[model samples]
Target: MSFAKWIGGALGWSFGGPIGAIIGLAIGSLIDGTAQQGGFLLGDGQTSRKQSRGTHNKRPNYGKQTQRSQTQSGDFEVSLLILASVVIKADGIQDQKELDFVRQQFVSMYGKERANHAFRLFKNISQQQIPTRKVCMQIKQMMDHSSRLQLVHFLFGIAKSDGIVVEVEVKQIYTICGYLGISSRDYESIKAMFYNSSDNAYKILEITKSASVDEIKKAYRKMAKKYHPDKVIHLGKEHQQGAEEKFRQVQKAYEQLQKERGF
Candidate 1:
């Protein structure tokens, strides 16, 4: 397999995780010659770079894109970075609120320091343009079924990072997901996970260490009914798999509580 395929597969497995991503791309420099130009990095404040022929609004540039192929590791990162930058800045101006949100994701994916590096690199890549459609097609070819789903989830997470979703960002992600062969149902599954994870964790397994065993049981029962993977099986095999994964998490959380309290 090529480096791009290896990295994509690794990243798809981790999904929004940085360590695995960095590890996957460890064969060479994460930042390539195409990515080493002057541009606003993740935390480098809002600034523009040199634009392509049609790209008027100036931003930074890691030089000009000589070639564009999502199959190339550099190109793939460039595409993702561009996608992320566009999503975060879709609201007219890129602000600290949005940057902070992306930063937090960086920390989650690669830890604070490495994620910082990723942030910088991503910012640089975003300022430049590669063949978007060609790269998207290449990405679709390499990213497998489950990996594509995870990509949609990452896109959703990025959109949801700032607590408000831009219509453009939403449409862009939807389009990209479509390009990757992700069904509407798959898109919805990821979107629901993003919106639901923040507030839904509590509802999934109601358990406070201080709460009595009765409360725990009640919460589990309610969650079991609500999150039963079987309930959404009609959605299709992909959805059933997703729901099953979620159900496993629910089961694990409940089991942990049971063990802690000796219930």
Candidate 2:
């Protein structure tokens, strides 16, 4: 499919906010040759024909009061592209490894054709100055909690792709977690997945080593429910592999705890 049609059909609520603006700029450079064909692009970077009618005249509602709708795979894809760019640049160096990781992950989740389209947009997005907080807040407002968690998981994968998650990258992801309304516990839970420490298992379970076996078991069940691949099933099967990775980590942590305590 054409890039314009893929974007036009894939996005939902994201076609109307700061994300929309970023996507608008990226597509501006991408589709200049096809501009006259009147694909998704319109005046001033507007992507949606329906939104341009009445919503375009009014200011975007970025407030917490705005009602969130079901997040589409395209919305998740766009958000991932923008945030991946932010995390990759957090350390002041755009390591090719990190870029390759992004491409590889996209190829794994989306087929080569779609991944190419996404990477093309990603390159354009990387050149601009993104207002990270605004973009994240928009995502926090519009995206479901499960999908948001998936985003954090994928980001940690990117930061770790270079073989070491730098301090700056950690701090950047932490700040993003805050803006995305992810709790400190949730942040640490996902963060532990990419690191090795004596207490990583506990962190993954969102608990402490001091907890009794019953508590550990309880935490395991809760976490298993939270990270289950089905939680993000609405996002489609392409995303299930990532969510399943998280779920497996939780099981590993629990099993490790069980063996240690012999319970």
Candidate 3:
């Protein structure tokens, strides 16, 4: 119900996001009272003029978290919540299944109690008119390529929870991928797991529409190594199954292409 639940490490919402311009505050713990601070704002509520003027006079120790390990999980959690909210809303209707899917993901990382609490904040996140660019920019700043790829995979699962990945969701995902700096091949590789279309083969192998036979062969070998299900075993069986699906697609696409091109 508060920005407190949305983030941990005491990184106040007001201090975490760009200030002066922030009109809302569900996660409003700004940096002592600076316009440069960005927070994990919860609702439209914002720091009043009095609070922004440094009534507390004490700043959070964002400086203490100089190492990546200290903030990786925190960053991933907040980023996932923001991006998932957009995917859930892509179809113009928020389905219960989509929400449950997201909660399941949280439950895997956090225990049941914490997952439920995060879900409540996620509901708040879903309703907010978040500046997609700004929030994602912060996330992009915190996460690396591996982290970003996992984010896209997790989102793909949510969009497919209702047994269909709608067009709007796909479009929104493409935009988010752009913001997250996910390569087109990487995006399509994940997308193939949920929605396979005419171009899926190229996507599976991370090739191009105009790829030649030799190029396709090389891409297949490379993709096989890259997406080997064993690579994601630590992510648990559920994620392993998803990885398996993608792995199978890469193989199937390879065989199909071989036949199509008489290779």
Candidate 4:
């Protein structure tokens, strides 16, 4: 008989005669065997006890699932474009400097073809409704705090492309950084570094206030070559703009040091 019927009859036979007891015993044994085959057992079944108490043999798909989670959504597409627009407009001029930077950054991180497509996609998204936090949350979920902070730095780099970051761009970047959950101090630190990085670059290149004329020229050339936009052209147009701007500032720093030192 089936397990359900057996259970019902067995319970009903609590006060039945010996014949009822025998039938119940046989049915209970049959039900117990079936339960064991299906990963269960009666109270005293050794196989059930062992299986229940033993470690699971199944290997989890954690890595696969984690990778899947990382690429689960396409939510960053719009936000990245929005931020790109913000950075490009930061200097009040959407010149080659800003465009080149955006291109190179995307290309390095996402590949040239992908970067080109992304820029085009960004343009399209710019025309549409800017998505709300609900959409951005999906992208944020995929990124850890460090990655978010890095993204903010990239934004800052773009913002500083044209030598001067416009107030609108600064406010937009601050808002974007806030949405990304980056602390204000961290964002300010990143921005401050950008603002003062020409000096830092000069210091690193050993172009001091007392540097000679030839020394300043040599330093400027070295700095220009190091940050040359041509090297990152493979990153595409958007990225080249930023790198070009950086190279320009490198040249500017060298000139400033020269002027101060009467080079």
Index of the highest-TM-score prediction: 2
Candidate 1, residues 75-155, lDDT tens digits: the string is 233345655665665556666767777677556544575466667666554454433454445456544454345445556
Q: What is the lDDT of residue 236 in candidate 2?
A: 70
Give the top-scoring candidate (lDDT).
2
| Poorly placed runs, candidate 3 (over 4 Å) | 1-15, 18-24, 27-71, 208-214, 224-263
Candidate 2: where is the Cα deviation over 4 Å?
1-5, 32-60
For model 1, the run of ten residues with the poorest summed lDDT: 44-53
Against the unseen true structure, what C-alpha lDDT does each candidate score? 0.49, 0.84, 0.63, 0.49
Cα TM-score per model: 0.47, 0.89, 0.64, 0.43
Candidate 3's residue-wise lDDT over 103-140, tens digit each?
A: 88777656676576557657766777767776655555
Clashing pairs in 1: 18-109, 37-62, 48-59, 48-60, 49-58, 49-59, 49-60
> Model 4: per-residue lDDT, tens digit, 50-99?
32232222222322322212210122223455557655654455678787
lDDT of 2 by residue, 1-263 (tens): 34455455556778877999998898887686444544332211233333333433343477656777666677788899999999999999999999999999988987776687678889999999999999998999888899999999999999999999889999999999999999999999999999899999999999988999899999999999999999998777778899999999999999999889999
TM-score: the better of candidates 1 and 4: 1
- Candidate 2 lDDT at 26 equals 89
- Of 1 and 2, the candidate ahead on lDDT is 2
Off by over 4 Å in 4: 1-79, 89-93, 129-138, 197-263
